[model samples]
Target chain A: MNAAPPPERASPAGREAPRSSVLVAERLTRRLEGEVPVTLVEEADVQIGRGEFVVIRGPSGSGKSSLLYLLGLLDRPTSGRLLLEGEDTSGFDEDRLADVRLAKLGFVFQFHFLLNEFSALDNVMMPMRRLGRLDADARRERGLRILRDLGLAGHEHKRPSQLSGGQRQRVAIARALANDPVIVLADEPTGALDTKSSGNVRDILRELASGQDRSIIAVTHDLHFASAADRQIEIVDGRIVPTGTMATLEAAAAAAKAAGTQTGAAPAS
Target chain B: MSLHLDIAFSHLRSRRRQTVVSLLGVVLGVAFFLAVSALMRGSELDLVARLVDTAPHITVYDEYREARPQPARLLWPEGAVAIRGVKPKAERRGIRQYRRKLQTIDAIRGTQAAPVLVSQAIFSFAGRDEAVTLSGIEPARMKGVSTIDEDIVAGSLDAVDTNPNGIIIGRALARKLSLEMGDTVSVVSPTGNVRAMKIVGLFETGNAGYDEGQTFAQLTRVQALMNRPNVANLIVVRMQDAYAARTAAAFIERSLGYKSVSWQEASKDLLDALTVRNVIMYTVVGAILLVACFGIYNVISTVVLEKTRDIAILKSMGFHARDIRLIFVIEGAVIGIGGSLLGMAMGSGMMRAVEQVEIKPPGSTESITLPIYWGIDQFALAAAFAILSAVFAAWLPARKGGRVQPVDILRGAA
Candidate 1:
């Protein structure tokens, strides 16, 4: 039987669409350590809808992280059209990019890289204080609200060194959410968590993407995590294989529930 | 901006150890500069003060090169030959007549006319005798022209005014003869005349010129002792204008025939020495300020380097380069202002301390005291130098900070 066609990603109308896609890629490519350059997403015409749960997935060294970085504006793409909210960001200088990152975007790295010197509340307030428009009371109120929202209210005064790994990651999440960013580009949000913590982080990501109406483009190699996403793009050797069918919920349910199931959707192991 | 200032202050407070070490050089340099300058200025005050004690600001004297015609001689009528074959005497008589003409000049407000007797006097007291120049002065009139009133330490000038037989002797002379107040001293003039006088007061001008070689007496008494009537030697005139003394002297010279000089001319070397001292003091202080500026530059430069990351973050967050520069400049300026004020207080206190200590007179059986002079100008200059040096010191390092790139800062490359 012929595989189902890929779903077209179009920005929703009327809801004051995201500046553009939280992540946009046209032939997004990155190269590491000598030899031929790896095309992370070859002419990968993808637009992340506002408040959409878009996931990029592939095996290790498949350029998933590279695509996330290029989209997050953390790393530059060699040759690609990156229109953040329909504005060309390819020529944006570092300072301007930092402004976009501060006012328009937030990032959740795989390692939960929180500044070690400050307490969790201070870390949450870092972006707002750095931006410098808010007074002390305002910054404190905003930081505390975010920490409480992330279920880490009691941990607000604790330093990162004083917190557990999960708590530290939650603090990082609170920090990213502090300034109320339009989009959260989390690179492997649950990549380092235990099974329970991983599910917790995944559930939070899903809620932020669907419930709170924030565009989330998370990069992950876990098929289980990617499977629950609204949409997933599988990259291999820097290119998306357009011939493969996009597996729907029915297909996913059948693959997991049927006995002696011979599945063609799983990667050829 | 106050916010940044608050931040800067708190930041410095946080790094108290480094701030103290850094500010130590500035503090010491300011204090040293202020103290030395104050002492030099004090020396100038002392020199001027001593000169002001002995030097005559205005001398109204006999401008006549020769003796003036006495009132008794003037009775012979105008152009009458009073002396036969004594042309020098007659010429002296004419010049003396001219000196009498100066009395009519209205600008001569106060005159202390005295016969400056140049004859060697054998001043014998307690069997010890020495040659001395007797300056016969009207005690009341001398107070208007010089600081002679301050010279009297024992007895009184009023006694010299009341008693014609009274004389004012120097402290050195009193010591040399082992004499005290009320002791008799015999003055034997070169004319083979002798007169005994009682010592009424001891005067100390703190200078050998006045203290060692001179004695004061009533002008009439000295005139009678010399048997010179209607004939006075040099007349020391005191006038209303201290600075105009030279011009007044020149006027007197042109009007009459005697030579007259100003206090400035009399003590030119003393004044010159004071000026040279002032220049040397400024140069020494300037060197201190220069070194302080350089030290501050190094310290502030190091601080800038340490704060480069924070500066970058500030800039990226919308702080302008000018603002960052202002922070450091303000920091330096604050250091300078603080150091200057503290140093001035310290220096002024030091001067007061010097004044409080009494140093015994060396080689003497008495005590002597000196005061440390403080002036408004000295403090003003020192304070201005410190503040200017600090601002100038901030320039180089502040410029370097302005050149820092945000990209490099975030990357830890700055």
Candidate 2:
């Protein structure tokens, strides 16, 4: 397992290497409740490399979301090692964990949890506003840019209820990426989306992962999404099963595409 | 901080019903607080003014000793202890010197001499004679030195000067004697020595103690009746500042013991009642403010609940707990300041309205009419109380908002 790990390159003094894989968790464990006390992840060491598209696939109770939460520093593990941008996370309290999460990670929930009060642009601008360094014009500019990137520029003034499900999800994604976090963690992001909407969101996630070279660890039950990742990790009964990479998944997908072409025009389009 | 305020308002705006409820709480609280505060001030000012107008700011009395008969004085026991009194015996010999000492007090306006005589006198007015103790004061000196001048209702004070044997009396006393101005009244001493004085005027002093039992006459005449010429038993002093009465009286007593009493010390019962009323006013008004703050707490707590999820999300976004608390505190402060201003306006308006309604005394009686004057200090006090209540009410909710955990609330545990 290469226990000593690699000698990571030192970031330039006073400058963090952009797109650093800022989250690491090894052998993470969580107890749900009761005397039995289920361990969510045991001896599970996962490295989400910089710019890597890491997809975790599992069934409903496979603790896939739990691992994502642990990596995002939203929940503490009963016992395990977690390093956020190479700093040991065990010593971090709730407040310190919040600091790490706010500075380094973004989250997209299965349900698009948009704060219902604010318009889409304001929702995206909220984190920056709370941080309070930027003036009004700067906040507006940054918010518009993120909204524009998410294809939500036109819907920026609309409330969440006025937007389509895909648009709402995109807004949530924009809000998540507002801080330009080092990593984006999505748990069942497409679970509420239709096939078309899901594919659009999947495209957005892939772009975020590769073009921006932001590390993405998405939890999904979708085999195709998991297979399409730079790496596929399977979890069953709270432990990860070793898996292969995008090259193998691409070959398999291509074979499936070819086979499907003879029968129907590739499902939707 | 501005960012937190924006967030706080956004959260508050998100729940319109709750925000309105909270704002209503603050408004009512402030209004009641200010109203009660103003009422208390109005009542207190009226009482103090009444006292200041009718009562002497300072009074002086004779320090007396039980005169010993000849045998007891000649066979006086060795080392016989004498009681120490308000004035020492040596100072009592030169008592007139004490009146001069009162002049040193900056607020001493003037002094009036009254001979408090113990001789039994029969007062025959409207064909009846009743025995009473006689008190005498010079009319001009009384007008110059006491509150008696303005208190005269029916007749001129100069009338007392025109007739050497003239006297002024309380309306109740005059009614009891069935006498009017210009009616001659015969006063017979216990020794069968009689004198007649004309009814000069009638006065009403509001207080029952003075109105029922007091009569004023020319000082020298009463002095002759008491068999002491050019001598007064008691001297009443008036001061420019009412608050300085007690201090001045103390200084005068040390210089001339048994020679003076401040209005407060003379009328302890009345003064005590005034003090108690002041305390009760503060307590009752304070309780009203407390109730108002309670309402504010109710409204803000609901606000805290409605914003819990937003607070969690904000916390997750790296806003500290202190920041969350500050947001709610700002909200509370805004409500407090607005309510306080509103309360002050409403209270001042109420006082003005009250002052405008003329309270006429019964049946065209020439009596004292009291007015409620709005003082600046009253408004400041009410505003201060309202603000304190508002801040206090907001404190608990702000703390609860701060303590909310982001993950717990997002997971619906909060």
Candidate 3:
């Protein structure tokens, strides 16, 4: 399994990704240390290239979000290595990893976790202020420009509670792009939005990848959302299953369930 | 830093009632600390100042703390010699070679010495007899060493220079005898010698017993009447700095071979009581601030708990754990500084109000306003203690806040 090439490289759609890989994982695994010892993600191999929009799809409890967290440096792997912008991050401490995340990556959670007390503009400027690479005037100006570009020009002063669900998610995205991160990771970005708002958020994330030359990795259960991504990776039972064999494996698992016993499907030869 | 402060202020503002209540605790603690300490320290200093100003700083008595060694003991060397029931030799009771001793004491810097021959006497005026203490003093020297010169209500202490037989008696004594200035009274000493002494001056020391019994005459006149001429029994020394009297008295006793007692040594019991009082005062004040700090700890702890989600979001945004901790600590500091400033002002106002209260003490004829010490150090001390306690109180909760794992909170929220 470790010798197998990453599924993105074998897929015809992956040929469109530029050769520059922004993030790569080599058999990364994370196990929760407890008496039960739950394996959240195991042997996850992935490659996200520049300007590529990747969607991770899996059933509930399949560790789809867990894998995205590992790639985003929000969670450390128990074993194996993760590389961000060609820098091996397994040796980095928590603070060093956070620094890298602040400088190179952004995140949008399932809930648009904009600080409720702060105005939308201040929320967007938070990452910029934390990075401290830009002066106050530049940060404010850039924050205003980003919010305006996201169609939230006049609503920058509104608090999160005052904004609509879709507007709040847009602010979260604006905040994610505050420091001009090389890659943006979203977990169920449009999960809480209506159909129209979900479509709007999907378009914005796709444009951020294709138009701005930044990578976007999203974990979504919405097939309509997944269909718009440049490539799709499917995970099952904490392992990434190749798209070619996923149907046969699902059918086998359904047959096993029908036979009055619950077990994992055998791997396709 | 500004971002942390912004979040801290936002959190505090969101819970305005709790924040203000914690702030009020600090304010009241600091105000009461200043007010109570000022009163305690003020009364202590006032009592010490009265004691220092009214009495001699150091007194050199014509006495020895230890017995003189016998000639036999001096000669024995290592021999076991026992001398029993040996009667002491009779001697005149006075500081021997007084003029030379006076010159020696005069050589010491920052000191003024007055020679006094204190003797027991009886005053008889118009068939009334009063037992009294007759103190013979040189008018010019006594003026420099004694507060009696300031207490003279009739003739001056220098009147004894013109009339060798003149005596300065207290007003209470003169009133009891129905005697006026220029009235002559017969004074008889323990040695049976008698003299007709004119009442030339009068003084009132505000001490009824002393005013009724103490009499002052010229040194020569007292010596002549007592039949012990040239004998001065006591050397009263006053210093420029009363606080330096203990060391000066020790040095004087070493040089002069007499028992020297500083004012502080004489009133040691009173000084010890004041020290105990100061300890109690500080403890009570410190406890007040400690209680105030508990309020701070409570408020910050609640904020940390309530803002757990915010903390998690901030952490995911790449904020370090210290940043989360800093926001809460800054909240504590803001309350500390703001409350301290207001408390100091309130305490000063309280001090001013206390200073306006006038009361007549028992046996005192005049009413005096309460003393309120406005020392800057006490204000600074209160502020420093309150702020430090507030920070310390914030630190406990801050460590817990800093230990918050973003993953745990994020997972829980999800």
lDDT of 2 by residue, A165-196 (tens): 99989998888877677788887888888988
Q: Which ten residues in a row have the lowest lDDT in candidate 3 chain B?
A: B405-414
* Most accurate candidate by DockQ: 3
- Candidate with best TM-score: 3
- Residue A55 in model 1: shift from native, Å? 8.9
- Every model's DockQ: 0.07, 0.34, 0.59
Interface RMSD, all candidates in order, equals: 5.9, 3.0, 0.9
lDDT of 3 by residue, B1-414 (tens): 998899999998988999999999999999999999999889999999889878889998988877788888899968898888988678888887888988877788888999999999999989988999999999999999888999999999999988998999999999999999999999999999988999999999899999999999999988888888888999998888899899989988999999989999999999999999999999999999999999999999999899888887888889887888888889889888888999999999999999999999998889999988899999999999999888889888888888887778767766
Ranking by DockQ: 3, 2, 1
Each prediction's total of clashing residue pairs, residues at least 3 apart in sequence or on different chains, is 9, 5, 0
lDDT of 2 at B246: 87
Query: Which tens-of-lDDT digit does each residue in A1-269 have in candidate 1?
Result: 01111111223452355444555667766654358743555556677877788788766666666677667766666677788777789898766776777766776766666655468997778777656656788889878877886788788989788998778878877777666666787778787888877777788778777666677888887777887788887766666644233344336646655755666355442
- Return the clash pairs for model 1, or none: A19-A85, A20-A85, A27-A43, B59-B237, B60-B237, B61-B235, B63-B258, B67-B92, B68-B96
Per-residue lDDT of candidate 1, residues B1-414 (tens digit): 664565456445645666665566567767777678766777677666656556666444544445666654687666565664433443342124423554643345544433343345789776777888786666765665667778889987767779999988888878878889999889988778988899999988777766877788876777677766445555555555555666776776676556666676777787788788778888988888778778677777877887776666455433456767887888778778877877777777777777677778777767755645577887788889888888889778888887776544433321
Could you tell me the TM-score of chain A in candidate 3? 0.88
Instruction: Please report the TM-score between candidate 3 and the true structure.
Output: 0.91
Expressed as tens digits, the lDDT of each residue in A121-228 for candidate 3 is 999999888888888988898899889988998999999999999999999999998888889999999999999999999999988887776789999989899999
